[model samples]
Target: MKKTISREALKSASLEYNDVSGDFNWIKKRRGPIKVGQKAGSINHAGYVVIKIDQMKFMAHVLVWFLKTGEWPTLDIDHINGIKTDNRFQNLRHVTRSVNLQNQRKAHPNNHTGLIGVNKKGPKRFLALIQIDGIQKSVGTFENAIDAHNAYIEAKRKGHPGNTL
Candidate 1:
């Protein structure tokens, strides 16, 4: 059977080392090199010597650590807000590769139909399209970029169930 350690037990247990700092405390043995845990190779929480904290799985915890500690993470934490670093739990959302691509912003100049809308055979006019769940959906065509973007947003809201679009 799998063994589960209670939070109280973990709290009372002696912590030999703190990954945040190089110092070691507790126990009679002098400070020495800490042995890496069995789950050390796992990404997200690999650096910490204690409990595993998977930022991808538990984004709220990641935001809490950042907000309370003011430590910037090395990895890119994208918020579903279209704003890359909002980090608010309500605004934060887990996204797959395709879904993330669907939410990407428009590319720079010279890149037509890269975002905002899809270009037709004609010039200036564009069709707003959003791909969700591997299905391509055309929102509608418009004369202006903003109109196309708005259409895309509306379509996104419709496509994603229970999504705070």
Candidate 2:
């Protein structure tokens, strides 16, 4: 039977993947000789050898040890912040993709008035409106774009985290 990992074991495994002395643990070593269908293993600066087993990448030897001893975590490890490659356990968590996306700040530009709002009179002023439960509700309007944006933000904070006007 295939071995699964426990939560404690996963945590322990995660620690070895991090640097004991330094704040970061996932640093790219001299990039060389990585290919598909090959399990290349190496000793990280954190003082542990990381190897790929059965097409799975472990951050460190301890992570593989956890795989041998416990079940795999149900959720994918996510970086709470927007970083893509940082693998510190404290920065990592088991979360659904939607939850992770919700926790993230808007990265895309093109949001006029610095918030969700509608432009009027050739962009002279903006009126903010948000849709909640399929109903469009006017948040407010402002002479200045920034003020309109602030109003939109306030409305968002009041229980409309997903509101976009």
Best TM-score goes to which candidate? 2
**C-alpha RMSD for every candidate:** 10.4, 9.1
Against the true structure, candidate 2 reaches a TM-score of 0.44
What is the per-residue lDDT of model 2 for residues 19-122, given as tens digits with 9 covering 90 to 100? 33212232333245544333335656644445543445455433532333364545444455544444344545665554444443442366544444444424
* Segments of candidate 2 deviating more than 4 angstroms: 1-16, 19-79, 83-86, 92-98, 107-122, 131-136, 160-165
C-alpha lDDT (0 to 100) for residue 104 of candidate 2: 36
TM-score of 1: 0.41
Report the poorest 10 consecutive residues by lDDT, candidate 2: 21-30
